[model samples]
Target: MASRWIRPEVYPLFAAMGVAMGICGFQLIRNITTNPEVSVNKARRASGVVENFEEGVKYADHRLRKYVRNRSPEIMPSINSFFSNPERSN
Candidate 1:
């Protein structure tokens, strides 16, 4: 009787949602456990917050600056330069 209301075609959608929810739940638990900002005690939390903030700033600066400096401005450089020096087919 329960199966009558739930169509077979909808099973995959339910499975996908379950997997997505599971992944989200796992990440939340991992972050709560491992993140320094969420310290076990109040005293440590303050220090952790400051230290993590500095680390985050440095990391962001290095990653963003490096990528911006090194990456090509063109969207598809190779394709864009295809006809730049075309060879005569004769």
Candidate 2:
């Protein structure tokens, strides 16, 4: 059970605490492990590029879908061709 009268400011404080705890836990694990630097560095390096490319693809697909939704029927073929262009193909 929770009280409805709780101040909204408390939510952010709790959220921050949760994030801080998570970061501290991660650092603690990193400090106690053997070869933590190598494993963490490798993971970070791989994740950075992978996350960026994934985000780009996700946003591009989102924008393309939105464009298609708003597009006139007459321009459908041209739009499809533009997106399917070999130069831009992934």
Candidate 3:
């Protein structure tokens, strides 16, 4: 439904912002629930279940970033190499 006060062009912007906020909120809640350091329960905080809290956090929320940590970051290797070559600058 279109409202007289809001412009139709602004709807997509609102939807994009809503989605971004939702993802951020989901991550925040996930960290609070799974990470012992941030968990609400005292028992889980002191259970010694995760010897290395950092590793545990990574494992609990493993994503594309973790899996590709070792790979080259260039999205277009050929393009990057072309621009970086000193001879090309001349």
Candidate 4:
């Protein structure tokens, strides 16, 4: 069994490679988690994006309501036609 195994002269090379890989992984995780400006900016940007999206939804809802009100006379016919029209079966 010993004769078929790797040579003893190269054992340290594998250990050094493992240690280097571990250090690189730890440093990458630390850089993402520990930077104060990056963390704060990320939170701020996420909240700003959420707020903007909420405002856009509200604005769209308001516009849709206004459109419905302005076209009240045609809304029922359009809805009825939408449900009963044979063309929709396709």
Highest-lDDT candidate: 3
Query: Which regions of candidate 1 deviate over 4 angstroms?
Result: 40-43, 46-90
Pitting candidate 2 against candidate 3, the one with the higher lDDT is 3
TM-score for all models, in order of appearance = 0.45, 0.32, 0.59, 0.35
- Name the 10 consecutive residues with the lowest summed lDDT in model 4: 31-40
The candidate, 2 or 4, that scores higher on lDDT is 4
Clashes counted in candidate 2 amount to 0
Q: What is the C-alpha RMSD of each candidate to the true structure, in Å?
A: 6.6, 15.3, 4.3, 19.0
For candidate 3, the TM-score is 0.59
Q: RMSD, model 3, all Cα superposed?
A: 4.3
Query: What C-alpha lDDT do the candidate models reach, one value each?
Result: 0.70, 0.63, 0.77, 0.64
Per-residue CA lDDT of candidate 4, range 1-90, in tens? 775777888789989999999999986775555533334465665764343556455545664577677564664686687778869745
Q: Please provide, for model 3 over 9-85, each residue's C-alpha lDDT reduced to its tens digit, 9 standing for 90 to 100.
A: 99899999999999999989877776655657777667755567676767565687677888898899778878899
- Cα lDDT for residue 77, candidate 2: 75
For model 1, give the 10-residue run with minimal summed lDDT. 81-90
